[model samples]
Target: MRITTVETFVLSERQLLVRLGTDEGLAGWGDATLEHRPGTVAAAIRELSGYLIGEDPLPVTAHWQRLTRGGFYRGGPVLGSAVAGLDQALWDLRGKWFRAPIHQLLGGPCRDRVRLYTHAGGPPGQTAAPERARAVVESGYTLVKASIAGPVGFLDSAATIARFVEDLEALRQAIGAGADFGIDLHGRVSVRHARRLADAAAHTRPAFFEEPLRPEHSRLIGQLAASTSVPIATGERLFCREEFVPVLEGGVAIVQPDPAHAGGITEVFRIATLAESYDAQLAPHCPLGPVALAACVQLDLAVPNFYAQEHVIDLSSAGSSDLAILRDPETLVARSGYLDRPTGPGLGIEVDEDAVRAAHRPDLLVPAGNPSWNYPDGGFAEW
Candidate 1:
C-alpha cells in the first residue's frame, strides 16, 4: 500500500510523537521524545516526514539514511532521536504488511523466551527502597539490579562510599548468593572517586557496574575498567553507532542502548552488532514506557550478545501515566529474570492512545535534582 499521511502528537511537553498512516488504514506509532524537548523532536520528525510520506514505508534503511544524511550536518540527540521514531513506525508498518512479528522480519527468534532483570534493592527499607528489592526476590527473580548509592559527585567523603557499601552488602546478603546483583553508579562520580568506589564494590562481586562515570568522561572509563575487576557498562547517552565506537574499542563489558532514543530497532540492531564485535554484552537501557520496552524486546530477541534487560516492572507507584494506554498492561512479567518474547504483530505491545492523551503534559519535564538528596546543596546526586 502507498503512504497516506504523517502526523505528530505532543500531548504534553515530555512526549514526542510520530505516526504514519497508510492507504490500507495501517498506522505505526513511535516515540522520540527527549526530557523537555518533545516539541523539538516533533518538529524534526515533521520535517523528515516530508521525505517519507510519498515513499514506500517499508524502505526503512533508505528513509533512515535520507533523514540522517539528507542534511549536510547530522547526528545528535535531536536528529538521531527524530529518525528513531520514524524508523520504529516504518518497522511497525512493515511488520503489519508481512503479518509477522518484528523479530521474524529481522531473522527470526534465537531463543524460546527473552530474559529480563529487576531494578529493586536499594537501601534497607520497609518502604519503597529495600522493601521493593525484597519483594522482587520473593516474587522469584534471581537476577536483580539495584542502585547501590544515591547521588555522589566529585571527591566525596569516603564515609559515603562506606555507607554505600554497607547498604549494598546488606542487599547482597539479604538476597543471598541465589541472586546476581548489578550495581548502577549513574555516572555522577569522577575517575578518582570511581576508582575507589569500584575497588570497594569489587569485593562484593557485583554482576557489573553501570555508568560509573558520565558519558563524556567515557575515555577514562576504560582506565577504570582496567584498574578493577568490576565489569564496566555504559551506552544510554549515546544516540548512534559512531558515538559507540570509542567505548567498544576501549573495552566495555556491556553496552546499554535505548531503542526509543537510539534510532529505534534499526540503529540498536547495529549497535548490538558493533558491541558483539568487541565481545560486549547488550543490556538495553529502558526506563521509559512499554512501546519502548516492546521495541527493545524485539531487538534483544534478535541479538545473540544480550545479557539482560533493565525493566521498570513496578511503575504503578510512579503513576506510569503512559502505561495506562499499553496494549498489554501485563507486558512486563519477569518470572526467572527474563521477559518473554511478545506475540503481537509489529512491536507487539500496543500503545494506549487514550492513556497517551491523558498523560500529555503541555510543559516538558526538566532534570530535577537527585530524588535521594533533599539536602540544601542537593544530595550526592545521580540520574
Candidate 2:
C-alpha cells in the first residue's frame, strides 16, 4: 500500500503517536515520545515529513534510509527520533497487514516470558530504609533498583560516600538475598567517585552498577567493569545501535536500549541482535508511557539474548491513562520475579485514539527537564 499521509499527534498523555496513512486504509502506530523535548522532536518529525507521502508504507528500510541518509546532515536526537516513530508505524502497518505480532516477524519467540525489574523509591537519606525495602519485597518484586544519592558531584565528601554505603548496607541487611538490588550512579559521579561507590558496593554484590560515569566516557566503563564484579548497564542516553556498537564491544555486560529514544522496534531489534553477537544481554531502558513499553516487550519477546527490563511506577495522572490504553499491558505480576511477554497484535498494544487526539499536546506533555532536582550543595543535578 502506498503511503498517503503521516501525521504526528503529541497527546496530553505525555506520549507522541505517529499515524501513517496508507492507500489501502491500513495505518500503523508508533510512539516517538521524547520527554523534555516533544516540541523539538515533533518539529523534527515535521521536517522529515515529505518523503513518506506516496511511497509504499511497507518499505520501512528504504523509507528509513531516505529519511536518515537522504538528508544533508543525518543523525541526532531530532532526525533519528523522527525516523524511529515513522519506522515503527511502518512496521506496525506491516504486522497488522499480515495479522501477526511484531515478534513473529522477527523469527518467533525464543522463550515464553520476559523478565522485568522496577525502581524502588527511597528518601535522600536512610530515613525510610527498612520500610522502602520491605515495601518493594512485600509487593512481590523479585528485584528492585536504587540510587544512593540524589546528586553526587566529584569528591563531594567522605561523609557523603559513607552515608550512601551505610544506607545501602542497611537496606541490604533488611532485604537480604531474597531479592536482587542494583544502583544507578545517575552519571553524577566522576570516575574517581564512581570507583569509590563501586568499591563500597562491590562487597554487597549488587546486580549491576549503572552509568557510574557519563556515557560519553563509556570507553572507560569496561575499565570500571574490570575494577568491579558487578555488571555495567547504560544506554538510556543512547539513540541507536550504531552508537551502541562500541558500547557492547567495550565489554559492557548489558546493553540498555530505550525503544522510545533508540529508534523504536526497528533499531532496537537490530541493537538486540548486535548484543547477541557479543553475548551481552539486553535490558531495555523504558521509564515512559505504555505504548513505548509495549514496543519494548515486542522486541524483548523475539530477542534471544534477553535480560531483565527496567520498569517505573506511574507517577502522574496522564501516565496512568497511557497504560490503560494498551491491549495487553504487563503489570508487576512477578511470579518468583518474571514478567510474561504481552500477547496482542502490532506491538501488542491498542491506543486510545480519541483520548490521544483530544489531548494533543497536553499540559506537561512536552518533554522538558525537571527543575526540582538539586545537589546537596544546592547545585543543579541531572533528573
Candidate 3:
C-alpha cells in the first residue's frame, strides 16, 4: 500500500510525534523529539514528507538511505533524528504487515528480557538526590542513574572532587549493594577534570562512567577509560557509525548510541553490530517518549551485546497521558528493572491517533525543560 499522508504532532514541549498514514487505512507512528528543538525536527519531517507520501512503507532500507543521504547535505541531530523517527515508523509498519514483532523481523530474540535504568531525579544538586535514588530502588528498579551535582571549573580543587565522590558515594550507600548505578558526567567536565572525577569515584564502582567528555573529545575518553577501572560509556551525540570508530578503538566499554538521534533502527542495529566487533556493549540513550522507548526495546531484544536501557521517569510522569497514545503501554512497562520481550507486531505498540491529537501543544514552550547555565566567572557551562 502507498502512504497517503504524513502528519506531525507536537505533543507537549519536548515530544514531536510523526504519523505515516497509508491509503489502505493502516498508520505507523514514530517519535522525532529533538529535546529543546522540536519545531526544527517537525519541520524537517515535513520537508521529508513530500518524498514519502506515495512511496511504499515496507521498503524501509531504501527509504532510510534516500531520506538520509537524499538531501546530499545530511547528518546532524535534527536530520538524523527526523530520519530515525520515520525509520522507526516504517519498521513498525513492516512488522505489522508480517504479523510479527520488530525483533523477530530483525534477527529474532537473542535475550529473554531487556534491563532498564531510570534517572534518579532532576539533576544531582537537587535537594533529594539520594532520597530519590532510594525511592527509585524502592519502586523495584535494580539500576538507577544520576548526574554530577554542580558545575566545575577548568581545573577544580581537591574539595570539589571530594564532594563529587561524596555525593555518588552517598547515593551508593543509600541504594545499598544489590543495585547497580552510574554517574553521567553529561560531557560537562573537561578532560583533566573528568579524569580526576573518574579516578576519585572509581572506588564507588559506578556501573559505567557516561560521557566523560563531549563527543568532540571522545578520543580522550580512551585515556580516561584506561586510567580508571569504571566502564566508559559515550556516543549519544555521534550520529553515524563512522563517528563511532574512534571511541570503539579508544577502548570504551559501553557505547550509548541513541536510536532517536543516531538514525533509528536501521543505523542503531548497524552500530550495535559495529560495537560487537569491538566487544563493546550497547545501552541505548532513550530519554524521549513511548515510541522511542519501544523502538529501543525492540533493538535491545534482538542484539546480543545489549546492556541496560535508559528512561526518564519524570518526563514520562509529566506526560503520563502520552502512554494512552499506545494501544498497550503495559508491554513497554518495566518489571523488577527488566522489560519483558514485546509480543505485538510492529514495534510492539500501537499509537492512538485521538490521544496524540489531544496532547498536541504546539504553543507550549517550557523553557525550564532546557536551562542555560554559566560559570562563576561568567563563562558558558554545559547544562
Q: Rank the models by lDDT, top first.
A: 3, 1, 2
Q: For residues 1-383, could you state the per-residue lDDT of candidate 2 as single tens digits?
A: 78888887876334677888888977788877676667777778877778888887766777877887887887666666677788888888878878888888889988887776777657665422556666767766666787766566677688877888777777677678877777877777777777787787677777777777776877767677777677888887787877887778777888887777777777888888899898888988877666666677788888988888777745223335446654333442345445566556676666666666766764554455554777666777765
The candidates, ranked best first by TM-score, are 3, 2, 1
- Taking all chains together, each candidate's TM-score versus the true structure is 0.89, 0.89, 0.95
Angstrom error of the Cα, residue 7, model 1: value is 2.6
Across 1-383, the per-residue lDDT of candidate 3 in tens digits comes to 89988888887656788888898788888888788787888889989998799999999999999999999999989999999889988998898888899999998999988888888754545412888889888878888998776576778888878777788888889899999888888888888888888778888888988887877887777788778788989999999999999999989999998888899999999999999999999999988888889999999999999989998743223235547677677776677777888899988987778988988887753423677788888988887
What does the lDDT read for residue 355 in candidate 3? 83
Candidate 3 clash pair list? none
Which regions in candidate 2 have their CA more than 4 angstroms from the true location? 12-14, 125-130, 313-322, 327-337, 362-368, 372-381
lDDT values for all models: 0.75, 0.73, 0.84
Task: Judging by lDDT against the true structure, name the best candidate.
Answer: 3
Q: Give stretches of model 1 more than 4 Å off.
A: 11-15, 121-128, 148-150, 313-322, 330-332, 352-359, 363-383
Instruction: Tell me which of candidates 1 and 2 scores higher on lDDT.
Output: 1
Steric clash count of candidate 3: 0
* Candidate 2 residue 356 C-alpha distance from true site, Å: 1.1
